[model samples]
Target: MAHQERVVALLRQPNSMIAEGFAFMEAQFVALHEDIYVAQPKGFEDPVHPNHVYKLRKAFYGLKQAPRVWYEQLTQYLLHHGYDRGSVDKRLLVKTTRNHVTIAQIYADDIVFGSTLQKYTDDLVEVMNKEFEMSIVGQMTYFLGLQVKQSSEGYFISQKKYAKNLVKKFELESSKTPRTLISTSTKLSKDDAGPPIDSTVYRSLIGSLLYLTASRPDIMFSFGMCARHQSAPKKSHLIAAKRILKYVRGTIKYGIWYSKESELSVTGYCDADWAGNIDDRKSTSGGCFFVGKELSIMAEQETKLNFSEHS
Candidate 1:
């Protein structure tokens, strides 16, 4: 899913790429019983072979081999049409020409496609519909839990509903709003002496935050700090983690914005906070790569060895 930013970068790079249209597709599949002896869907079974299992004509969703079989079929179809699969991400397919280009990304059952030419996009949609039961969802606004809003200026993606639900899920909807992602003056320790909280809820909250990080990099650092104490979270850690939700409450609409006026250049910046964690005295470092401030990549870590003094 992090590849989304890079995909946007490709769309915004002028002279090479232009978003003609965005479409979503779902592959049709017929389900067969996992076990040969097990009964299958009412009429899908073979007429001649009553006791024998029916052969699958297409990939069945929820089956272990369904994704692989579907990809195989789709891959062959795209390759037959002159599309080349990505070297890094096998699910990414690209077809380029002197005048135009088309890129398609496949995630499980859903596919998102865009091209430099509107005719190409339309033709691709028509062709895919002819071959398979393609859904032909026009102009992708929602995919994989991320809500995307496209405009003449650029694209905006966020999990606003998910963020609000998260706040309410933890019963913090009415809590005081937090301005900061984390309180700078406060220090969180192991807090082994403090009262313990439910590990299940704490872990679930962390998991939700991790998914929210897909479009909300602002909470990544604070989430990481709170995640480390998941093994045995204390009241202090819970309070700190809840602070992030309160912060989300205040800025529910915050999200990653990709402007169409992006430059075709990659810029990277990194920062280090020496001995930031009082519990272990570990320095925290984080970095982000920007394609003209679009935030293509983000990463952070807690380093046990202090390197600030050496530098």
Candidate 2:
């Protein structure tokens, strides 16, 4: 998703279009290179060959090899038509003609693409239609769970619906909103003696919040602290997690804005705490990388250290 966002932020300066392969995964349009056979389904067996298995000439939903076959098919088609696969990301395909360059990003069967000229985008759709079934999404408003709002100024990306659903899932819709996600003075630790809570519920909440951090970097550290006790979460840990939900409730519409005014230069910021974890006394380090003003990448992890026996 980070890669997708970065690509959009970088390449969306020009005309852009989004397309999806109709019935992409379950479609029988994918041809198999290797011969395979499967048992006939009920009511589909032939009368003469009742015991014989059916030979597969095309990829199907239940087949484990279907996804790979479809990807290979698309790759071969793009390569044959002058599109060069990206050295870093194989799914990214680029075609250069004269001074105009068209960029296409493949996410399974969906394609998000753009070019400096309108004709390039039109030609791309024309050729794709001749080869495969496609549904042109016109302008990209939503993709990969991120809500996109594009304008002359720039793009606004968020997950408002996902956040609302998350609040409802945990039954925290009517809960009072908290000013802070977590108290600055509060330090979460394994409460071995405290009353136990459902580990599954605690883990699920933590996981969802972690995903939300993709677009909301402010909650990263606070949620990371609550995530440590997922294996044996207690009442205190659950409370901390719920606080994050309340905070999310109040800030559901918040999102990052990628402006056309900002330069494409990459910038990164990193910070760390000294022995922040109370249980293990390990420092947590984190970094955020941005393309212009838009955050494109973020990561956080605990540091491991070895102590000397003499000390």
Candidate 3:
């Protein structure tokens, strides 16, 4: 019911052309039902039946065709207005004019839109409001649990608040912070002789860190290494998990910063050791990509540029 109301509101907003479209549809339905029975199927035998209700003249809320009908209607309107749907992501609508371009992303009832020029953005909003009943929330801050921090330099996305909540949820407030993600000397093994811990807790910690990796690529290798032992995690695996949490505690404020000066150029460096893992005797590969010269230097300094250890 709520969904239907929302769709109807979008069609009935002031200055909306959808009203005219709806009227046209209603007229078509009436013309189609002129000779056909307008009452319930069972009541069609009795013309004077008072309890008989009129059959639906147009797509109704519970009808299976409702979504398709609405989609066709909206798509036709956008196509007429010069908006093109993205090939890969259909929810993305783009409109490019002589001086500016506007993009809108649709996620069910929510929308995220941006533009290269303010006039274009405003024009889109006005047109949408004229056709749909929508409330613009203005500048976006948090969407789908990602905390967006936009700056003149570039956008910085993180989940600091979500990380804090996770820390509290796991009761890791008393844990000591670790200096490094993992110790070079410590080697984790699937030890049959070692003591076992709660596999559920170990898996939960890994899951949390996996999500943190969205903005904290520094821990990707370490997390991937620890994830291999989730099937029968031992004390050593738990220790590694705690180490990652401690690292998070120490660097909660850390995040990736996309600079405005950054170009579209993509460069990558890969290095691996002969046999970094003692258990499987398999090599550990590490690599990082850069968009600009600044990122290349940063990656070099942080990764140590040691091909021997990485290769």
lDDT winner: 2
lDDT of 1 by residue, 23-46 (tens): 223463733335323355687866
Model 3 residue 164 distance off true place after TM-score fit, in angstroms:
1.0
**Tens-digit lDDT track of model 3 for 257-306:** 65555444557787776566666677766677665422332221122223
Error of 3 at 162 (Å): 1.1
Q: Higher-lDDT candidate among 2 and 3?
A: 2
- The lDDT of each candidate is 0.77, 0.80, 0.63
The 10 consecutive residues of candidate 3 with the worst lDDT sum are 15-24
Q: Which model is ahead, 1 or 3, in terms of TM-score?
A: 1
RMSD of each: 4.5, 3.0, 11.6
Models ranked on TM-score = 2, 1, 3
Would you estimate the TM-scores of all the predictions?
A: 0.83, 0.88, 0.64
Tens digits of per-residue lDDT, candidate 2, 1-311, equal: 33444454445554543443343544436889999999888998889989999788888765788767877887788788898888779989887777666778777657787765678888888777777777776778777778888777777889898999999999999999999999888988888899998888999999999889867888888898998898899999999999998998999998888776676677899998878888888999999987777687888999965566873
Model 1, C-alpha of 90: deviation from truth (Å): 2.7
Instruction: Determine which window of 10 residues in candidate 2 has minimal summed lDDT.
Output: 14-23
Model 1, residue 304: displacement in angstroms? 3.0
Residue pair clashes in candidate 2: none
Give residue 201's error in model 3 in angstroms: 1.4
